[model samples]
Target: MNQLLWMAVGAGAVLSIEGLYWLYWRYVGSGSVRDYINEDQEPEGDYRILRKIKTPNQRIALVEYRGQMWIYGNGDVMFSTTEDENMYAEAMVHIPMAAAGKRNKVLIIGGGGGVTTREALRYSEVEEITAVDVDDVMLEFGKHLEAMVRFNRGSLNHPKVRTVIEDGRTFIENTPMKWDVIVIDVPEPTGRYPRLSRLFSVEFYRLLKERLEPEGAINIACSTSFWMPEYFWSIQETLKKAGFQVLPFHHFVPEDGEDWAFCLATTSPVDTDGLRMLVSTEYLTPERLKDMFYMPFYFANGQNQGDIQTDDNTVLLDIVSEADYEQDGNRKEYN
Candidate 1:
């Protein structure tokens, strides 16, 4: 009976030790062993940004994580792989460039990967491209990375392409020249840097409005359709208030779950038929343009209203709070 009691105590002690080890591994030591192995391997498909290269500005080392690529900017995971860099760049750049009709002088804000610049140059109509990125290392990585360079097709070194290492907001504020089209591909707002947050602010959109040519348009990378509904609507509302006729659209990215949203704003009407003439891709079509305008009920319900107090007023702030009221017990309001 004493031996049996000893055996039970021994078993209990072993279980306790194992439980403590598990907790330490799970919370403190590191992630799971599988994650550790994946990190060491740096697998191709599941790329994530492990660290930021601060010497040459805030450039990120993107690696595969959980079957998706994530970009770490300044030790924070800024962007996650929702769609391929090529696909996202193409949509963000091509759509606005095509809609603008003639691309004379283009300005790209926050396209660290150089993907947007690559896509913009695809239109032979473009005379010059001014790409403003805060990180120089991102450009270096884009040049060296076979997949990224191949996808961009050496557009980064195009004759008309001139690289400018500067903050987008500062550049916009100081530059006297107007652009035919402006594409903003900056990080999402975590409310850390007010400049990045300002992109979604009324003042920033107003600045964009000022810099745009009469017929020119702008495209902004909003945010994930799934996670941050309020952030997305706020941007759309702010753009509208800044005197732009805003069209919020989204596409599915396999890396990022569900759907991704982008806001395209213009002073002039978009000639979807005319825009379709420039692209030879399977994605952009007249039919697709028509479909792009059709907002989902959940998204559409968030549009800004005239009376609602919002970050912007010129454009309708889709009253998302009311939508929350309507949703009642069904959905929780996204922060």
Candidate 2:
């Protein structure tokens, strides 16, 4: 009977060790294993999953981390409860507005979580904001998700805001209103993003420029300058083809994990004179703004590496795919 009791205790010890290892793997190791899991698990510590949903359109998740909520969609960080001037969303919104020199009426295309609208609302001169997003699911996240609504500072339902569920190209084609600033805050064109190719095409830029008021400027969310330098160059050339003077700039967004590029294009000359920030920004000093427009000499050497995207010829996807695959290869080699 004593021997049997010792065996039982030994089995319990083994079971306890295995159980602890399993918990560690599930919480920590799972994140490191490639293809081990499709989604992120609830992180350790104060971070907790408030809600997670995988819709046909995209995966939406809300998590509380460091005393704030972060919204992720399709593995990309979308919005966070932390509102700082250095955040990418805030800087992107304010950049074009500053370049425009007027914030009277604004139109935001592909504003997934209403964060851009929230930033735009900081300008009292912004009379109305129309946020057009193709995905109703994303708009619903902005509207129904408590954490998301809080991050957007109630701008989703603000009197100055109007949410429209429509394709950005179609909205620009049909809307009668002209905007002083048009902000394109859509997802990047990489990784199975649907219908984003045409949005980056020359045809789309022409349509966007048509909806801009005279002296108005448009800002497009080009991909990261680090991994996707060619992508930014292609956009600059494409915008020039559409008859707008392009000024390329980049901001390092901590949540994005890279330095993101934004292109400010205008039918008229881009005038920095009298440029003033209506809203306080953390990273966009006047000196920094001037420096952001300068491209490294190496990038300028290969201006025509790829064809500019058009309605008939969509090649931005291929370019982004190639760049991303190269990054994957480098990662594998390092490993």
Q: Quick one: best TM-score, which candidate?
A: 2
Ten-residue region with minimum lDDT total, candidate 2: 32-41
TM-score for every candidate vs. truth? 0.72, 0.80
lDDT of 2 by residue, 1-335 (tens): 99999999999999999988987775567532211212322334666666667665566666778887676666666656665422777667887888885679999887768888888898988899999887787788787778778777777799989999988888877777899999987766655465678788999898888888888888998865465566777888889899998877776546535566788898877666456666677667777666566555534424445468887765777776776567646622210
Q: Pick the candidate with the highest lDDT.
A: 2
Predictions: Cα RMSD each = 6.4, 4.7
List candidate 1 segments past 4 Å from native: 1-59, 64-70, 74-83, 191-194, 253-257, 271-277, 301-335
At residue 27, candidate 2 shows an lDDT of 51
lDDT of 2: 0.73
lDDT of 1 by residue, 37-141 (tens): 323223445344454344544434465577554555543444333445556666788778777846898998876566788778778778999888777666665
